[model samples]
Target: MKWVTYEAGAGERTGILDGETVRGLAPGTTLAGLLAAGALVEAGDDARRAPTEVLGTDDVRLLAPLPRPVSIRDGLCFLDHLRGCHRALGRDESLHPAWSENPGFYFANADAIVGPYDDVPVAPGSTMFDLELEVAAVVGTGGRDLDPRRAEEHIVGYTFYNDWTARDHQLRDMAQGIGMGKSKDSAITLGPALVTVDELEPFRRDGRLAFEVSASVGDRELTRGSLATMDWTFGELLAYVSRGADLTPGAVVGSGTVPGGCLLEHVDTPDLAAFTGWLQPGDVVSLRGEGLGETRQTVRPARPVIPLRDGA
Candidate 1:
């Protein structure tokens, strides 16, 4: 069942997406509640019961599918991405052979997430905006120090993620041995809908999830890669992250960026001005997976600001 958080006349509520229509759930609805409610309603069912019984399309504004996630973790699991990016930047020496052997990840602020339809604002006083197309999973059960072999059981479903980056800020922070710069603002865009594990099981073969990922800016195709290229499995990432830490339900974990994923991996003489050269106001970024639905976002300049008066 595809789930979503959306806004109607009644305000933000959880719902299921059926075709082009949306069926609203109760206010403050949650994945846990749906599970507890047992009979998860279909979007079509909700649509049939809408005020006019015709599905209120205008009332539906898609929010991030999962509203109140407990935690969000992302993994750098793609090896081909690392190699291709490093090679593109002429920095193969910085590439670590063991990156694929061990899982690398980062924590994302769950509360700060935005939906696929939301307008992404570029950072002010900055010109180096970048995008990373990724596939991320949501955890269904809470566990600690989980064994890698059984880590799949903890997953609830999958969603598309665009790990937006400010390249200039990211580089400065990386130079300082921390990742604060790359992770500011509404840097993470998640949703459209959550495709459950059962729906994605067929895509997994020999213990690895396989899916094609592609990204585009307007009519320009930016990157294309597969989830099969990852060096470490999602299980490994879950196990590693769960060590001595609680993995709670609704926690999202990303599958990192794929090859040619971002300009950082594809460009040399990395600079903000040069990286965002192709991006202009009103450029649409579309990311799609095999089964998961597509998420399209338009790029817009950051909101203008006025300078503060001295000693105000």
Candidate 2:
């Protein structure tokens, strides 16, 4: 089932996407609301039988499948992403011992999520704005201290995610040995639709999602890789995140940037260095997955920053 949240005339509405048409759910029914009620699948079944309204996909505006997520935790599961980044920065490329022990992740700003087609603003004072292409899973059934073996059951669906970043801010913050709060809190793009786990059965390999994902800036493609390269699976990521904390319905977990899925990885690569650079105003970034759909956004100018320190 392909679940979607969209705007058409009245207000935000939930529905199921069947090819090019959208079959509406009960009035005012949202993906978040359905997940909280633990009736996401049931509602999809009901909509399939008797829809509130049927409209063409082009007739409405597609919003994030789970707009107001309870929380956002993006994982760093791909070994190549880490290696390539280190190689680019002229740093040691040796694997981190802790990375193999567990799937590492960090929390993101849940309130800053934007839709697939929304415009993303550049961070103020940022000259190295970037995009990280990934796939995100939305939790349907809440749980705590979940076993990695059974964690897959809690996933409701998957969607495309763009972890927009301000490289300059990220580097500065990282130097301080703290979280990447200002660097990534500006915006997160999600959407097109949330495809249920059952719908991606054919693409599953060893219980992990195996599909090609790519990113493009306008007409030129920058990065392309498969999701199968991750060292840890979503189940493992969920298990680690739920270790003493609650994994509630509507929480979003991301499969960190795929190998070569971000401009940062290509910054020092000879072949891509000439064509790729920090995102500029008017640059359109498009992230696409085999089954997860596309999330495209236009880069907008950054808002002026308020002065934190006085004096000349």
- Candidate maximizing lDDT: 2
Per-candidate TM vs. native?
0.86, 0.95
Question: Tens-digit lDDT track for model 1 on 227-280?
Answer: 887778888989999999998777889998987877666675534245435445
Q: Provide C-alpha RMSD values for all models, in order.
A: 3.6, 2.1
Pairs in clash, predicted candidate 2: none
Which segments of model 1 are wrong by more than 4 Å? 32-59, 97-101, 182-184, 268-278, 304-312
lDDT, each prediction? 0.74, 0.89
Which candidate ranks first by TM-score, i.e. highest? 2
Which residue pairs in model 1 clash with each other? none
Cα deviation at 186, candidate 2, in Å, is 0.6
- Model 2, 307: alpha-carbon shift in Å? 1.2
Per-residue error (Å), model 2, residue 206: 1.8
